[model samples]
Structure formats: structure tokens, C-alpha cells
Target chain A: MENYIPVLLLLGFAIIVASSILVLSWWLGPKKPLAVKLSAYECGVNAEGSPHAPFASKFYLVAVMFLLVDVEAAFFFPWALVYKESLQLGPILFVALVIYVAIFALGLFYIIKKDCLRLR
Target chain B: MNTVDIAILVAKTLLFYLIVLHVVPIMVWVERRGAALIQDRPGPNRVGPFGLLQPVADFVKFIFKEDPIPTGANRGLFLVAPALILIPASLTLAVLPFGDKVKLFGREILLQVADLDIAILYVLAIGSLGIYGILFGGWASGNKFSLMGALRASSQVISYEIPLGLAAVGAVAVYGTFSLREIALAQDGLWFGWLPRWGIFLQPVGFWLFFIASFAETNRLPFDLPETEAELVAGYHTEYGSMKFGMFMMAEYMNLTTISGVMVTLFFGGWHLPFVADAMLLKWIGSQNLLGLVQVVIFLTKVAIFLCVFVWVRWTVPRFRFDQLMRITWGRLIPLGIVNLLVTAGVMLWLGGWK
Candidate 1:
């Protein structure tokens, strides 16, 4: 736990450095806001509608897939750490890992076959 | 811990901070000059010798330029997003072991900001948080392009992260530890008295998977679809101006440096000189402190090479279509990463462990 103190200190240092840079620029920077300049940029044309317009559902699908795949990746970490030691359990541990990965691999294949990742 | 220990800790943290912070300008210089060299153009030669002062000029320009919060932009989130990205990128260096320990003032000091047992995991956790910066910047800006960029960036990062983490797991399996320092130390010595026992030799597939995933994670080209200038017009930071934009640029370079450092520590033997044992170096140098300094130099040299490769690849490859990027990660890299892990485990098991 004590080993983590430097990480906190580094985070604090980062905040200080980043904020100072922002503040320095904010102080020195000119503030002149024209209606045109302040408008949302749409290739220099009059901004059409709200920029909050709906996007495709493929992005949301990616997000959901990320959650499942990311969790599976997380499960691999502990197993990886103890893998060397677990070799003492003979081929049983390797077989379990194979089964675990095969399940995820099958899911990945299903996602592919469904063409859920198609951007268009 | 005593006062001396606390003081050393502060010094070590500051040193690592300065190293990561300074890499930004140097990399900016390299990226421009390197691009010019590749394209046969002079590139920023008017500013200082060999355009070395271009980053300084950029700094001044960013500071004095007008900053506008676009109409309908969320004031709070827009302001916080740049720092959100910068902080996590900077904090990752804390867990990287730049070198082995050095005896100072009768006490041994490890040449790392933090010696966490779960250093690699901590790095991944912090790295994943960087996506929030892009997400917030895009959503807060109230711009369609920025939102598109943010969504793309988020999905790209999260997708590559699976392979990245899996690759690291492969390293952990090979080294039998999660601590970056231990992994580095384990990589010392030679195999068959000829080849260095580096992680690359032990886990070659893991190395390639990690290296390729790192390009996506850092948003470097071929994988830089989120910020494709022709398509997205600077992507998630389209509405950002002045220092906020500068912060994003700085954070990108910082992430590049941090990722490169992690790559060095995990797969390239950290600070170990090839075929040159630490004990032999200590005896040759006749001082532990000087040897520590040498190790840091070695470590930074490896990191510098990786950084150059990043810039090189950026100019060499064309940007990937958004779909292609996602397909590569999900359809290819992730499965390859799993296979790499299983193969590593199988080999270790076949040999009854590397010990």
C-alpha cells in the first residue's frame, strides 16, 4: 500500500503542472468572441441544427462489446500471474484456460458472423 | 519511513515528472523534422537551429491566441477535459522502473517513482481513463465532428486495450510476476550463452501484439482515424483553441512517451544493457550510483528509439477507415493475443516452468 504513495504524489504534481499551464495561457490569451467565431464549426458554413444530432447505433454496439470483452480480459490477469505456479496442477489448469478462452473466442466469432460491426 | 526516505521519494517523483514532461517538446521537434525528412521538405527550419525552437514558438502562440468557448458548449466539462487527459498520461510513469536501485546516503533508492506489485495493472487502469478526456471534450464542445471523434476514439481505445492487457498478461505469464521491476530483473542474462533472454525472445507474439496495439492506444497513424484531419477536422478537439488545444497536443505526446516507456520496461528488458550484467557494470564503473545513472541512460535510449518508431510509422502509413480499425482489433489482435497467452502458458508448462 505504501508503494502507491508516489503514484498519488505524481497525480498531484500532474494536476499542478496542467492547471498552471491552463491558467497561464488563460491569463495571457486574448478573449474576443464574435458571434460567428463562437458558432459551432461546420466547414465554415452556417452551423446546421444542433451538434447533438443522433449518431449511428454501431458506436453503442461497440461500447457494449467493449464491456464484455474488457471484463474477460480482466479475468485473464490473475490467472496469468498464478499460471506458473498452477502448472503444478498438471494439464488441468491449461485445459480450464482453453475452455475459458474458447467461450470468448466463440462470442467474438458470433459477433463477426452477425455483421454487427458493419459501420454502414 | 524517515525524513530522508520521504525526501528521496519527492526527488524521485519530481525527476520522473520532469522526464515525461520534457519529452513533449523534444518529440514535437522530432515529429516535424522527421516528417520533413521523410517527405523531402525543410519543415520549420526558420525557427531556431534546425527548427529546434519550433515547439517554443508553438508554446508562445498557443498562450497568446484567443480562446473561445464555442456557442452552446458546456463551460465546465470543456475546461476540465484537457487536464483530464494530461493527468492520467503523466501519472503512468510513476509505476515504471526506469532502472535498478542505487545506494544513496547509505540507503538504497530504487530508480522508480513507485514500486507497486501490480504496476502493469495500475498502468492499464490509468491508461484506460484517458478516453474520458476525449469523451468529455467532444460532448462538451457541442460539435458533431467532435462527438463523432470522441465516440470513435473511445471505441478504438477500448478495443485495443483488450489486446494490450492480454499482451501484458502474456508477459506476466512468461516472467511469473506482475511487478515491472521484477519483470525487468528477470530479463537479465543470456540464453545458451549467446542470445539475450529478453521478453521478446520468450514471448515474440506477445511483443508484436503489444506493439501493434500500442499504436492504436496512442492514436498514431494508420490507427488515427478518430482525429483524421481530412474527415473529422481535428476530431474531438475541433472546438478547442489556444491553451486547451495545446494541452491536448501535449497530452498526446505525453501518452506516446508513457506508452513507449511501458513497452521498454515490459518487453525490451527495461534498463538492462544487452549481454552486460549489472554486477559486471558495477565492477567496471566502481560505483553503484554511477551504474544507476547508466541504467537510466540505457532505459531512456530504448524509449527514444521507440518514440522515433512512432513518428516514423505515423508518416509511413495511411489512416485506417474507422471500421477497419475496429475489425483489426476485435477480429484479429484480440484473438492473436489469446493465442499468444495460451502458447506461452503451454511452453512454460511443457518445460515445467522457466526456473
Candidate 2:
């Protein structure tokens, strides 16, 4: 817990420095809002729809795929750290990793096959 | 722990902040000057000494400039976003070792701010949170383009992060430790009397994957779909102006340094140089304080070179289309990263396992 003092201190320093800049700019910088300027930028035309409108499912799919792949990748870290130790226990760990990766690969293949990753 | 220990820690943390902030202006100068050199033009020479004062000038401008929050924008979130990005980006620097230690007046001072057991995990977790700054800035802007930019940045970050983790798995397999200092110490000796026992030498594919993934993760050129002015008009920070924008920019450069520092710590031996053992240098120097300073210099030099590479790659490569970026992350880099992990495991297993 003592080791975390510096981390917390650094965090405090970071926040102080960052917020000081924001506050400085706020205090010093001029502010004069116009409707034309306040409106969302849209290449000179008025914005057509709400900014919060739903986007494509491709984006959603990409995010979901990230979850699947990222979690698998996370699991790999501990496994890698213990690979040598676990290998001494038996070849079972190696076989388990093989099966794990195979399943992951199969899912990746299926995703690719379905074109779930494509933007359009 | 004690008065001296607390004092040293405070001093180190202060020094780290100063150095990182100092690097921001230097990096700004280098990126502009380097980008100019790449594009065959003179860049910012009119300001103090080859545009050294250009960042100062920009800072002044940012301070005096008007920062108008849009009519429909969420003012609170719009104001908070830059700080979100800046803090996390700077926070990751706490765990990275610039040098081993200095023996000062019968006491020892560690070069790093913290030596946490979960240093790498801390870095990954904090680094990922940096995207929220972009997300908030985009969403609060009340702009279509800003939202698009936020989506792009978040998705790109998430996609590349998988490969980045996998790449680290290979390195962890080699080192068996998450502490950056321990990893650096492990690479102190030469591999074959000439070659350094660096991660790059042992895990070439892992290094490559990490390098490329870091590049993408930083939202740099060739992968800067988040901020491609041609499409989303300055991307996530479209509505931000003045120092709010500067904070984001500062955070970006800081993130670059953080990533470069991590790469150096992980793959390039941090402060370790080829064929020159620290013990030999320490003996020659005869003063641990001086050795610590020298080690810090060497570590900074390597990070500086990589930062230049980041700038160079930015100016050289064409920006990838969003789809291509995603496909590369999902298709090529991930599988290769997995393969690298497996091969590294297999070889380490065959080579008597990790020591």
C-alpha cells in the first residue's frame, strides 16, 4: 500500500497540471458564442440529423469482436507466463492451449466467413 | 518508508513531471521540423533558434485565444475530457524506469516513481482509459463528425489492443516478470558476446507486432483515421479550441512517449546498451549517482530515437482507410500475434523453460 503513494501522488499531480491548464485557458481565453458557430460543423451545410443517432451495426460488430478477441488475448498472458512451469507438470497444458487457440481460430474463421468484420 | 525515502520519492516524481512536460515542447518542435524536412520545406525557423520557441508561442496563443463551447454541447463533459486524456497518459510514466538506482549520500534512489507488482497491468489498464477523453470530447461536442471520430478512435484502440496484449505475452513468456525494472535487468548481458539479449533479438515477431500495434494504438499516421481532417474535420477534438485542444495534443505526444518508453523498456533493453554491461560502466564511473544519470541519458536517447521513428512513420505512411485498419487488426496482426505467442511458448518450453 505504501508503494501506491507515489502512484496516487502522480495521479494528483497529473490532475492538478491538467485542470490548471483548463482553468487557465478558461480564465484567460475570450468567449463569444454565435449561433452559426455554436451549431455543429457540417461542411457549411446545417447538420441533417441528431448527433446521437444510431450508427452502423458494423461498428457494433467490430466492438463485440474486440471483446471476444481481447478477452482471449488477456487469457494468453497468464498462460504464457506459466507455460514453461505448466509444461513441466505435463504436456496437457500444451494440448489445452492448442485446443483453446483452435477454437478461437475457428470462431475467427467463422466471423470472417460471415463477413461480420466488413464495414459495409 | 522514512523521511529520506519519502523525500526521494517526491523529488523523483517531480523530476518525472518536469521531464515529461519538457519533452512535449521538444517533441512538438521535432514533429513540426521533422515533418517539414520530410515534406521538403522549411518549418518554423523564424521563432527562437530553429523554431525552438514555437511551442511557447503556440502555448501563449492557446492561452489568449477564445475557447467557445458550442450551443448544444455538454459543457461539463466538454471541459473534463482533456484532463481525462492528459492525466492517464502522464500517469503511465510512473512505472517506467529511466535508470536502475542511484546511491546518494549513503542512500539509494530508484529512478522510477513506483515499482508496483502489477506495473504492466497498470499501464495497460490506464492506457486504455485514455480513449475516454476522446470519447467524451467527441460526444459532448454535439457534432456528427466528432461522434464519428470518437467511434473510430475507440474501435481502433480496442482492435489494436488485442494484438498489443498478445505481443506482450510473448515478452512476458521470455522475461517471466511484469515489472519493467526486472525485465530491463534481465536483459543486461550480451547474448553472444556481441548481440544484446534484448527482446527484439529473442522475439523478433513479437517486437514487430508490438511496434506496429503501438503505432496504431497511438492513433498515429497510417492509422490516424480518428483525426483525418479530410473526413471528420480534426476528428474527436473538432469543437475543442485553445488549450483544451492543446491538452489533447499534449496528451497525444505524452502517449507517444509513454508507448516509446514501454517499447524501449520491453524490447530495446531500456537503459542497457550493446556490449557494455552496467557493472563495467558502474565500476568505471566509480559513483553510482553518475551511473544512474548516465543510464537515464541512455534510456532517453533510445526513447528519443523511437519517437523520431514515430514522427518519421507518420510523415511517410499513407493513412489507412478505416476498414483496412480494422481488417489488419482483426485479420493479420491478431493471428500473427497468436502465432508469435505459441512459437515463443514452444521454444521456451524446448529450451529448458524460463529461468
Candidate 3:
């Protein structure tokens, strides 16, 4: 691809920058530490159970749902801008947008109805 | 059909990508120093030449640093996630018209890559894909903090995209075109012979929405909760190490440049200055050599200044509380964008904008 040069350059630059940040930190920072310094982070609270103790399924479920909808929010931009361009098929475009919105709203409704986001 | 033309295109693109990345070292330096000035403290001055080479030092550091992979992390997805984000972030530069066209080896070479008719759509689609990298990076890292940061970033960007797009309707309505070059050209002359440029005059609301959303999309200071250290302990990259983590940081700055470029192109009469008509300038500078170079310089200078503004603001503002960030986007920005759209549409329809 003619575009390969730019693509490669971008990736290489990313690698270079990332590598530099860490390398510098290591050079300047003190390396002295003990088993306690690198122990599993426990927020200064004693480990009550195994680190892999099962979290509430609801936490994972709600988090996944949150991510899904947040992404769907981003899709609205292009669709809104181009909706008018489909004037010949304006009705179809309108319905499609409506369907997308409905799906989004329904998902929101489901999340709320299920009380998934409520921290309490 | 021609080898030289293809080579020129690739060469220019490669140059542009490298140059854009090189800018980060400067941007990072600027942010550090500027934030100090803004907050009233000394920034990074201990390193080479007022920390000019701090980024270079950082570059060496990351290269030699220990890359510790989390034991249970999904190795493939973890590696792929950063690339996923980096690829789209880089690829979106394709449609941007960075400068006026110039000559290379007697054949004309445009400053942009192929000017696809769906350039605007391509930008949106690719930008949308950028979220996946963040999502998967968090998900694959097997760190709760990373996952939460990714979730926050993902949600923040998505929420902001709506108002951002809605605000652009006025411009689309007026210009009846989606292409950035066309939009820039439409604003060439003064409003009734005195005003400076076009989009700002017509759709200030759209400009605000776009700018606000632009910050959120790039995951900057206020919208940067995704990586906010205090709340999430490095957010999505909490577990990322070595070059894998480097890619994420580089991509964020690249996005800063990209969004700033888009904002300049969309709102600020990109590459166009007040009273500097190209035809009139062509007469003085000669149609061929000097004018093209000047135009390119002017365009880059404009984009660079905006990028600096991005750094300036990042250092100036306190990062918004997560609730505050969400409130601004959904409560204020979205409603304002929608209202702006409605008003613009009504006014444009009245003025025969679609005509």
C-alpha cells in the first residue's frame, strides 16, 4: 500500500515514545525495594480473601452494559450529519435512525429498569 | 500509472507522520512548562536545554525499560489493543488537507492523500473505531482499574459525539458539502467586505459544540478521567508496560493533533487567512514556486498554533470531576448543540441554504 510508509512511521513513533518514557523513569528512579514494596496492592487493607475471589456478577454485567451504550452514543454524530443527504430515501433514513435511537433508548430503559447502574 | 507520483505521495505521508510525532516531544515540553506558568511553579527545567530533550530522554527510558506483562492477561488482545487504537488514530490523517498543493518533479502533488468523497464519513468511522482499542486495552489488561478507565473513556467519547455532529449541521446546511476543503473555500472572502472568516460568523454554536466535543473525544484533561491518575491509578494502561504502554500515550497526543487539525479545518478557516486571497497572492509570489511554499507554511503554522492552544488549555484548566464532565456533555453541550441545529436548520431553510 502507498499508505504503508505513513502507517509504519506512526507505529514506529508510538513505539519510540512509549519506550522512552519508561526507560527514563527506570534510570532516574530508585530501584531499592523489598517483598513488601512489590506485594499485591491491598489499599493498606489486609487481604480478606483470595485476590481472585468472585466479584458480584452484577458489577461485571453493569460495566459491560455501560461500555456498550457509551459506544453507541458516539455513532449518532455521522448518522445525524448524513441523514439529510438521504433525502430521496428520507423516510427510510428517518426510520433507520429512529430504529437505532429506539434500540439505544430501549437499552437505556432496560439498564434503568433493571437498576443496574444504581450504586446503592 | 506513474511511479514518481506514487512515491511522492508515500514520501509526503511518511514525512507528515514522522513530523507529527516529533511534535509531541515539543508538546509534552510545552504542557509541562506551560502548566507551571499557569499554576505558578517551575516545570521541567533540570534536563537538557530547559528540558528540550526530556522527551528524548523519555524515549530512551521506555526503550530500555522492563516490560512486565500481567500474568493472566490475554497476550494477543493485549498486544492487538494498542495497535488497534494506534492504527485508526494514524489512518484518519489520510483525508486531512494539511496545506495548499505544491509541485514535485514537475508533477503536481496534493498535500492530502486521496480526497475521497466520503472523507468526512471516513474520519467519523475511523474515530469511532478508536474506542475499541481503549475498550479492549482495558478489558484485556485484566486490571480492574484499566477496565474502568477504558469504560469511562469509551462512555465519555460516545456521549460527546452526538452534540459534536449535531452542531455541524449548520455548516453542512450552508455549504451543502461535507468536504473540509470545500468548507474552507466557502469562507474565503469577508462578510459584506469586513468580517474575517465564515464558520464562526455563521455557526458559533456549532464551533463550541465541536470544540468541546473535540476535547472529550481526544480524552484530554477534563475528559481525561479515563487515564486520570488520582481516580483510576493510570486508567486503562494501569497494567500496560514498555512499548505497549508507549503506543497508548503516543496515540493520545496524535489524537490531540488530529482533533485540533479537524477543529481548525472545520471552524477556523483552515489554512485561510483574512484578506489573503490566493489569486491576489499568486500574482505577487508567482503562481508556481513561492506561493505554494508560503501557503504550506501558513497552514502548518496555523495548525501548530492550535495544537499549542490545546496544550495551553490542558495546563490551564483543572481536570473536571467525573460527574462535572458528564454534566457538561449531556446536560449543557448536547442540548445546546441540538438547539443550535434546530435554529440553523430553520434559518438556513428560510434563507434557501439547501438550494
How do the predictions measure up, each by TM-score? 0.98, 0.97, 0.80
Which TM-score values does chain B get in all models? 0.98, 0.98, 0.94
Q: Compose the digit string of candidate 1's lDDT tens values, residues B1-355.
A: 9999899999989998998889999999999999999999988898989989999999899999988898779999999999999999998888878899999888999999999999899899999899999999999999999999998999899989999999999999877788999999988878888887788888889889999999999989989978999999999999999988999989999889888988998888899999987888889999889999999999999999999999999999888888888888888899899888888888888999887
Ordered by TM-score, highest first, the candidates read 1, 2, 3
Q: Which numbered prediction scores highest in TM-score against the true structure? A: 1
User: What's the true lDDT of residue B60 in model 3?
Assistant: 67
Kindly list the per-residue Cα lDDT of model 2 for residues B103-218, writing each as its tens digit. 77578778998988677888888999999999999999999899999999999998898888888888887888788899899889786588887889888998999999998889
* Interface RMSD for each of the candidates: 1.1, 1.5, 6.0
Error of 1 at A10 (Å): 0.6
User: C-alpha displacement of B182 in model 3, angstroms?
Assistant: 1.9
Please state every model's RMSD to the true fold in angstroms. 1.0, 1.4, 5.1
Query: For candidate 3, lDDT tens digit of each residue in A81-118?
Result: 56555554435545565566567667766765776544
RMSD in angstroms, candidate 1? 1.0
Q: What is the lDDT of candidate 3?
A: 0.68
Stretches > 4 Å off in candidate 2: A87-92
Stretches off by above 4 angstroms in model 3 are A1-120
Reproduced native contacts, each prediction: 0.80, 0.70, 0.07
What residue pairs are clashing in model 1? none
